[model samples]
Target: MKQSALSYFQYPEMVLVPLILFFVFFMLLLFFITRPKNRELFKKMEKMPLEEEETNNESIE
Candidate 1:
């Protein structure tokens, strides 16, 4: 039987490289989310629904 030519990415173990790349990107995303610079923005977004409800109640009064 003739042998087949496989490229670098065609190897099963080569899948690990992409997996590691995605993990690194995930860590970067977590870092950005937890950074202090965005803290106030996250807090305001967290309270957005409650604030909207308060305004709606006042208007309905």
Candidate 2:
């Protein structure tokens, strides 16, 4: 019974440690990828012509 309890505790370190580490690593990766992409997209959006460009395109059509 004691050994079973010990194994139950040990199973998390053996299995869950790597799983947790992978989750953290992936979260960091997702943050880095999205942060820069979002900044770039926002910068581009800031310079975009609002209603003027659309009106010009409509007149040309």
Q: Return the top candidate by lDDT.
A: 1
What tens-digit string does per-residue lDDT give for candidate 1 at 1-61?
1244534335787789999999999999999999999999998999887874533445644
* lDDT score of residue 26 within candidate 1: 99
lDDT of each: 0.82, 0.77
In model 1, what are the clashing residue pairs, if there are any?
none
RMSD of 1: 5.7
How many angstroms is residue 53 displaced in model 1 relative to the true structure, after the best TM-score fit? 2.2
Name the lDDT value of residue 33 in candidate 1.
100
Worst 10 residues of 2 by lDDT: 51-60
TM-score of each: 0.58, 0.40
